[model samples]
Target: MTLLACVALISAAISFSSIAEPLTSAQQNQVRELIRDTLVNNPQILEEAVNAWEQRSTEQAGARLGKIIEQNKDALFNNAASPRIGAKNAKLTLVSFTDYNCPYCKQFDPRLEQIVKKYPDVAIVLKLLPFRGETSQSSAQYALTLWQQQPDRFLALHQRLMSKKGNHTKGSIVSALKSTGNDNLSIDKKTLDEVRSSLRLADLLGVQGTPATLIGDQMIPGAVSYDVLEQVVKAQLARTSS
Candidate 1:
């Protein structure tokens, strides 16, 4: 028999042996020796199989999230209080949950902005989820405050904060705002409440970290590539046009 066929037979046999019935002593010894010899001679096959398995698992997870995004569309996309960028009446919308101190979110922020610039008809919503610490929470509160009081400058503030390194504290936040020329920054309780609401919504949506993005009926769990962002947007546009 061919080596590949032998490997497949041994794999199948071992897989079914546990569930269907226990193998006899001779059968167990034969299968074990076969697997051991095959692996010792050609160990790369195991690595190949493991890689394939991981790829399949990731694809399955993405598919599951796509369905979940569709199920929770209204809450995910229709929050009027969410900080928005780009055209308000845009046909394409991208919603992102991010923390101020999240490195991935910071890295993706510029890319997201570029996408917005490239796609004039795309609207991007920024949902603050401050799970990092007090720094993240306080920064989000200040962000929400800016969203409420000076929305025209919110994007600037967001860019500044994301660009900042080290710990995010009240002093850091205030310093960033002052650098942006907002001398009198006052973060209020209502803004804090809004941040809290965002956190609750994130929990309901099963978002456990920063940089979770939603485009159409798909949730991308991390900082996706520019190509990925473009593809998702184009696909949504095609679907809408169709």
Candidate 2:
């Protein structure tokens, strides 16, 4: 127990002892009042009380956070505040935050294609998560600028970054961009700075892994399977219909 709590307990114990030792009735009342006041105002007593409450309710509290996540639903997926793709007002939107150097992300790309083709109403939004920092950030910056310069070439550039073996070197990225018929991807000083700003925002979204999809509030991390993804989409679609 904390020192303050120990002191309070000892004070109460002495008061009880006084009661048993034939203290006057008035003195007993005064001792009880003293104990009451200490409990009411003591910081240690308050901390212990709070800890007890949390110990009982922590599991329920976690479950409630889960429910809040579920109910908010669409607001989480349609986070327009972050980078997005596909139809701006799509009925079914799948938001993915990914890092180029993550191999699992490449595996996820094909699954996304299946989802999009299966559901035309569904739109895919891609957000950059160049999370490895420094070199990763630089690679992501180059990729984003290229997307801005030529969005049509984004899919090809994405493939190169995902497929390239070894550490994601600037040389590899430049080579991939060149191979995609965008030989003049000269990231000028101003463009590099702009991409850096956007990348920072992606990092703040708690993006740790690639191929992470945010279907409504339910965020599925890693390379989730098509069947698993399809189940979530169906449930979300059901909510919309209702």
Q: Which candidate gets the maximum TM-score versus the true structure?
A: 1
Show pairs that collide, candidate 2.
none
Give the Cα error of residue 238 in candidate 1, in Å.
Answer: 1.8
| TM-score for all models, in order of appearance | 0.71, 0.60
Error of 2 at 75 (Å): 11
* lDDT by residue (tens digit), candidate 2, 96-168: 7777777787788778767877876677776666666665676676667676667767777777777776468
For all predictions, the C-alpha RMSD in Å is 4.3, 9.7
Best by lDDT: 1
Off by over 4 Å in 2: 1-88, 188-207
In candidate 2, clashing pairs total: 0
What lDDT does model 1 reach?
0.82
Cα-based lDDT at residue 228, candidate 1: 84
Query: How much lDDT does candidate 2 score?
Result: 0.67
